[model samples]
Target: MALQEYTEFITELFESGKTHSEIATELQRIGAQSCSLMTVRRFCSDHNLQRRNFVSDESLGCEVLSAINQTGPSYGRKFMTGYLSTLGIRAGEGRVGRILREVHQPYNILRRQGARNLNPIPYHAEYMGHKLHMDQNEKLGMFGVTHVLAVDGFSSKIVANVTMPVKNNLVIYNEVYRAAVASNGMWDQIRVDHGREFFLSLYVQEKLSQHRFNTNRLPYKQTTSSKNLRVERIWPEVNTRVNYPLKRALVDLVDTDSLDMQDNNTKYCVFNLTCQVSQIGLERAVQSWNAHRIPGRGIPNTLAAGGCPQRISMELLPSAAEAARMYEDELGASLSWASAFGTDPFSSEEDRQQAEQVFLQEYPDITVLFDRAVNNDLSLFQDALLCLINATNRFA
Candidate 1:
């Protein structure tokens, strides 16, 4: 059969950076159109679908720089190559490494010689939702920023994540746990560190244990953060991609006597702004990570895109309202969604409104502000601090 009939489908797979062999195999697997690798290659050649036909090294280097800026300089040759492929830039690892050395020598050296110990502990998961790993990252906790993420073990996909001023139990329950359940259905078991912040989430997980796809195993397990390998492994990436850069900027502010960590008002403004920016970085990191193909495994987002085995009906799971009711019953306190990040930073509601107005007037785009800060533009941070301080004083 002529390959032209499957032109659109094959083009999509090719544009997704799949090799001729993989595309041909997929075509055969789906029984759409069985074609040999040579046929697929010839077809691609005929249609001028070559990934590097006219691309130049200078342009590729520019793309590498842009990717490095967004993902930070920690990505090695292999990962960077994969990341580039995800962007439909089919550069080889050797070429990517050469460019990385020329573009970011310092970071490349550090990444190559970085002291990273491997965890040899054995881990197993039956299916995509077999085991859910939840953990909190406090690398930026000193800056009054914390991040919580839930990762699916089998697929290594981040199912849910949230940024907050602190590890609030209610926020973890509502944002991370419930959000994962709402999006992907329930997991067979949840593994977390032994922290009180997970109390509410674990409580609800246990309550819904009976409805789990597999009830033979325990509903949840509390272990050391080091042992929670699935989620723990992501912290370093988070540190590199999100926390460290932001921390450096924040530290610069403190060293320059521009930010006061001890002051409640200053902490409040810093936490709110930093958390918002950190969340954006975290989201980008997650996107890059999910789409980047794993060495032996497939792309995380693709592998986990298909719903888990033993599909559980949504009606069987507790609603958000019902989960809140359960929280009230178990904790003997009213279920509250309050969080330090959400709490008013100013003295009064009116002051908070005025400060927000001033902030918006000065920095309308938080993302732009974050990008500037990441690039070592401390002036923006200084200006933001001044804007908030002056705004709060206006209503004081």
Candidate 2:
């Protein structure tokens, strides 16, 4: 196996934006006789082959500054590094920090939660489903809503979070509880502040019992926020990423008189447009938070790892039949049509319109539901939509 024989192939892969490791893996997959990661790295280094052009330090500094301005100084080193990667700037924290220093970029020192306490309570969770810390942030009430969040005690990964008009018990059960359990599976126990919204529900317990797990809830008073640091820490990220942006947008909407007239009096508008926009913003934040790599963290950085609560515990997730039955029981009707609003099933505008029309015709009730999502109470449309499809399949 001569190195010269595959030089052109390796160069082509490199030019095509393949990393050395990727190129080596590809070669191996194609049965390259002498391909190895070390060989690829050595060849690239010897040939002066690089991922991109060698931009000046000043140019890279400008890019880093621009990213910080877009993301704000509030983002820490790891998030900034990940954000830069998203922009095709493949640099480590050391390089990123140097650029920040060179550009005089001031890093925001976030005050640690529970910092004031002389002796903070030590908490630990041995596994992903060991304990879920549940809490609600009403800071977004100015934007006419509140966010309910569930964070895993172990990896600090968010289990499930939802923005709702009112933090009602039923809404918590349906949106937050169901979401957490269905996605991450049943925790052995959940800890929450003594809010009636979470405490009043036996619904969650009943559902967990069906999975052969007796889920317990430990409620604390207002003083427990310091002790419930797992979910409490998540609020800062949510406030910066989700709440702040929406608040500014809502204010702008009000100033422009863009809000639905009927929704003006409410603390939060449930208008379809408002809900859709808010939902997208919130979900994107959640995804970003989960995907973020926590630096120097003992656990896996990405939430896709089994250690993170964001990764579903498949063993405890309900079967298709059970999920369908639960949906029918909750919504009080069998879902009859397929909806593609979130799925992006159509590629063309004409096809999208056709699909939308077909869905509206088949599920006339969706108009009512959409109206509810928009003009009145907001519901978790995607979950309900999925359940409807699952239920339909069961009947078919």
Candidate 3:
């Protein structure tokens, strides 16, 4: 009397309105071994021959259904399982899976096809400021703008993001790196592509070396974007949220020729306007990105358990003077930096006069040397220029 042999007959009797106890008793009367009621019940349940009763309570059921509609068909059993937990439901994955199947929710999750080999190595940093990723996106170049971004490898928080007319090294230094470092402080290592825009790797190394910290340059060439996943992931969001809208606006403006789009000056005016709007959109996108919750982590970068990158990197902030000096060295005399530095450092006329007096008192002999140079007095240093240098150094 094998249970497998009785599966069909037992299913038929159970479907004919026979209870588990009655079915088990009838089988035993035929000397087909003593099958308990529990055994029969388990068999029917496992074989799907028993009718599953839906939950009578509609309170939690209504909430779950509402979540299904809100989350869309893309969400699967796993996501719903976690979501239900967050909603204070005690249902397990198995229960949630059954409910999803019963409700006929399609598994429309958009996923890449084909199998990918598992990577055992981790690409994340253990602490904030430990590592940062730098990357540039040129999809918006048709509008005469490029976007450069920096992201923290640990918190995935965007440290700096900027829109520039070109992807030159000077622009990258002034707009991207400087802005990020100013706000989030210095990072131990910066991982970027081997593009020339980041060619000042040696310069960065030199700056960090002054503070007794060895700045590691992780410049990858011919490598996949997976290596810089932290920053690479941000491009898609930026494109969809910011670039797409800007592109549409630009196209509309061109179609309308609202501001004399043909004239060079007018074109530039419109270009600048578009660039400004693009910049604002980029900023808002970054803010929203930092505030949005991370998958599996369940917290925004700003409120992460490990602390935001800016907060964790508080010690690395450079003074305005120091930051200015760095920008000067990295980018040379750019228009923006020139405007910032060439402007008067003195606040008032009295302060300017006092500084001028101090400078004249310290280097009074500078004028004498200047007058001599103007007179071409070459005989003053017949032996060597070292004496003239010494005199300048020794100034009265």
Candidate 4:
């Protein structure tokens, strides 16, 4: 029954969700040893098990809630407060709000529905607002939901996305407002499978009336899983092409020892500041997909602003053209073949001859696409030949 042994037991208890005081009293009850609150807290910190939701009122409210729950059913804070006082538990109004929001949450208390459904198009407003399917999912490394503003999974286009906490309806509307601003105006209909925390926000009606987008919203819950989400496809491409690149640019801007640096902060800053860069990045991503990097993903690269090229390259860089030429030579066809099956995938005596004729007739002998605009090195262009792949490879 050493103090250290007692402390170890107390730490285990705390890890098991037992309070410090409970551990203290229990240790003394077992006639082992006792520790102070400060020791218990320090141990918690050392183990990286900081107390969750450390608001004073939160802990206080949980105490109050536990007391009330043992007694009877008190629907919300107001009912619980009045009921608790009958048993001599008195708390202030401000304290209730804090406790309710932070500690004893009334929202998640009840499990109403598990899965969400996508109902048939209800009698809703016409055009612009019809069946804009919405879903939420998280990204790796950053464990936060990326609220997807989508339409049909078959029609994969990112209408909007919010990469922040969705606290309530007001917060969601504010995010929706930001997304709408990015997309010109409000959408007509918002079709969701589940009733989210922000579903009740009057922002939908208020903003609709103000901007006169005259939008209406409808919710359905055919299924709970967000598997068939068209917006999810964008996340992978975006992670690879947009988000990862942006993350890298920012990392490299500060990475003094980085062997691969993109000049100064200009490249990183461009994406952060201008929607144009975002638009172009999005376009290039679609183009990459169109190149059939995946089995099927070719689609329009139309961005918000007028069609601007994301892959802005100067005259073909010498190295880029050389690489392009090497790719062409290995393929034994013009640059067109290099554009299609990469440098070399398949070669047949007859197919090679046909490819040579096709490259000469249909595609130019030496077409040029500016190289990867890397490291503020627009001065260096990677000449990639754009030969159309087999039409069968086209993805909608």
Candidate 5:
């Protein structure tokens, strides 16, 4: 094929942030004739196709400051550069580092001091959907919060995550595993720690094993949490970004005697409120994680956004709702939709609805309530607790 014929293809790849050498290699891979790095570079120059760059140091500094404010100051040199690339801004690692040091000296020093010793683990997957790793985090469990996450082993992307009061098998299956399957298609193998919370999901995986793209591997594998490297690795990030702050706020409630965990109504109200707030934090963490680049590998969202190349037949994969029905059929029980919050503070569904109506009438905006709670405003917690108490008392 003529070089001119590859123009559109090269342009598309370039716009997606591929280097000239990478574009050239892709052209050769696609059977283009006489495609070379120099040829690709020349073609790009001729077509005026160039990578976007900050026009000046001052402008670059402004963009860097904006990103830091948005993503927090924990972003190191490489991550900041990669994140900027995702925003269509390209800058050298040296310049990014210099700007970061000049701007956020304290975080830079702390980052260097707090860097952990690396102990690399050998891991591999043939393609995107080859293996799925699942795990639950209970760092905030004492405060009635739990998190379940599913990560794609090949792409290092968090395929699915959910926040709940505790690790429930049905919730893991429906919200995490089945949700992942629905979004990313079926994986060749599922890996998880030997937690009973995963039993339902694993059973469903085994039942559908034959439908996997590669049937040679077992449908699921159970191992120690430590050995489930991919999913386990993500917990530190979650702890730093989501768990730690929320845990501190919840603990303050206990220390201040503002939240009575021992009381059933208080526990229910706190659990529901905390679960909502933790979910907001978890979502922000997931977005930051997926968009931030990993060294040697590209951005997780970019890599895994393209559905699995070795995707199993979608027709064979059940939707989350269908999987729930299938689980009920196999287990002879309907899945409970109650999260860690359990039932409402009221005695019956009707009472619960009435209580919610009263609560909504007083609170008016649950979003603002959760937002204030997430910002570590302890007063919001007290306000919510007081509101819930009054609402439930009216129902009683």
Candidate 6:
């Protein structure tokens, strides 16, 4: 019954023009072997059944080609696929790729090459001008001082480093820029420790660039990337090792604030120059620190006090007479002789110009800063202030 039934099923299907699948299913019910698939192909070939192939109409292709040419060289295979799909002509990727190549004229194949990575290319500490690092401590609703630390990585010099108020943007910006410009026309890269003050708006970049110096508004980051490291990683290291001496002078150190400033501002520095001291006494002050922080390589770490100086005038009315006297007291005494330095300076015209390049190394700023009025008398706090100025000026 099984063999007879299998033979009868195929004979009936073949006569009735049913496909081999129908014969196979009938045969399988009677436990037949799996040989119907090859039989179907062989029968089809023997009968010479004409296979149907799908092709777009030549007129349609001409229309499509015209539609394609109507547009510029912008459309590629992707665009063609989308356009064809809209017209109910779903084409394969291979066809589209081929059509795009021929119709698009000279087809271009894309290729890329990478270089063998060499040593890391170091980032420029300065942008158009110099590098400025800034940090501001929040007062935390107290009378405590807010620290603004601005250092120039190029020089390892503190441009405008001092403690003030959390809300003291004027003091920070005015002083920092002054230090930067007096020596090096405004800062280019201003790195900060992500503090409130150092974070500037994009408008600030435009505004600052409006000045003489051109500054690109980069987000002074604190990474060690050769492309754009904010240069903060090196700051703490310098603070402890090469510049360890300045740590004692500074207080309330913020780990991140140094980063905030480096991403923002550029400071003054004196490297590779014949240095001249602003005053002998000021030199003595920094030199004294050498006892604690002596230079192994001829005072490699000479530090300076106070910001860049500019002679600013004050007008006081005669009605309130003590204004002139008060100004003198605030600045302290004008040290007739220079202050103490942790080191000495070259006392020559050549040295003066060279030191002027880096305000820190060349001429020690008058730390006990006293802005004596042009016409004002230096009678009031002159003596005490001068002593204070001298003492601070002598820091190395």
Measured by TM-score, the strongest candidate is 1
Question: Counting only residues 3 or more apart in sequence or on different chains, how many pairs clash (N, Cα, C under 3 Å) in candidate 5?
Answer: 0
Write the residue-wise lDDT of candidate 2 on 135-213 in tens digits: 8887755544677887777777776777665566556655676676676566666777767667433333444444433
TM-score of each: 0.78, 0.53, 0.45, 0.27, 0.73, 0.27
Candidate 6 stretches with Cα past 4 Å from truth are 1-128, 137-143, 165-167, 199-205, 210-396
Ten contiguous residues with the weakest lDDT in model 3: 380-389
| Residue range 1-396, candidate 6, lDDT tens digits | 223434555555666866656666666676676556666446544554323333454544564475353222333454445445545565554566566655545322310121222335464533224555555433221212234445555444444444432334334444444444454444454555444443221123223443424334452444323323333433332222112222221112224232121211111111111011112211222222221221231211232222222222122111112322332355462211111112233345565454344443423443221111111222221332223223233331
What candidate 2 gets wrong by more than 4 Å, as runs, is 1-70, 84-90, 100-120, 199-202, 210-223, 245-281, 299-304, 307-396
- C-alpha RMSD by candidate, in order: 6.4, 13.5, 22.9, 24.7, 7.5, 30.3
Among these predictions, the greatest lDDT belongs to: 1
Q: Report backbone clashes per prediction.
A: 0, 5, 0, 11, 0, 56
Model 4 — which ten-residue stretch has the worst lDDT? Answer: 379-388
C-alpha lDDT (0 to 100) for residue 47 of candidate 5: 91
Best first by lDDT, ranked: 1, 5, 2, 3, 4, 6
Q: Would you list the C-alpha lDDT of every candidate in the order shown?
A: 0.80, 0.56, 0.55, 0.38, 0.77, 0.36
* Alpha-carbon shift of residue 3 in model 5 (angstroms): 30
Q: What TM-score would candidate 4 get against the native? A: 0.27
* 185-268 per-residue lDDT for model 1 (tens digits): 778889998998887888888987877788898999999888899888888888876787788878887898977778766777
- Error at 35, model 1, angstroms: 21
Candidates sorted by TM-score, best first: 1, 5, 2, 3, 6, 4
**Candidate 6 Cα deviation (angstroms), residue 277:** 24
